[model samples]
Target: MAIELAGRPHRVPEGSSLADLLAALGHAPQACATALNGDFVRREQRHATRLAEGDRVVLVQPIVGG
Candidate 1:
């Protein structure tokens, strides 16, 4: 299946979850914020958030500033 990952088209195995995609991409779940289809997804929900084809996934890094 293919999904829009960070604005680019990315292919992933069927039944891949947000957590699975993160691991496959070498990203730590705790290192960034996750969103599916423009809606924010909590850390604990990643494992249960099944990804569907063409789903929009966005990963945002933390901004540290004062």
Candidate 2:
């Protein structure tokens, strides 16, 4: 499936969850915020939020800068 993450196209496996996607992208699910199809996906829901075809997923990591 072709899902867009942070404005970049990504090919993720079928039935992959937010956690799975994050892991594939070399990111830790514990350290990021996720949005699927324009709706914010909470941490508790990441395991259950399955990615669908043509779904747009945006994952942004928290950054602290002085």
Tell me, by TM-score, which candidate is best.
1
Distance (Å) between predicted and true CA of 3, model 1?
0.3
- Residues 2-38, candidate 2, lDDT per residue (tens digit)? 8887777888888898888888878876888989989
Model 2 segments beyond 4 Å from truth?
none
User: Compared with the true structure, what per-residue lDDT tens digits does model 1 show for residues 1-66?
Assistant: 999999999999999999999999999889999999999999999999999999999999898999
Q: Provide the global lDDT of candidate 2 against the true structure.
A: 0.86
lDDT scores in order: 0.96, 0.86
RMSD (CA, Å), each prediction? 1.0, 1.2
Candidate 2, position 34, lDDT = 88
lDDT of 2 at 44: 88
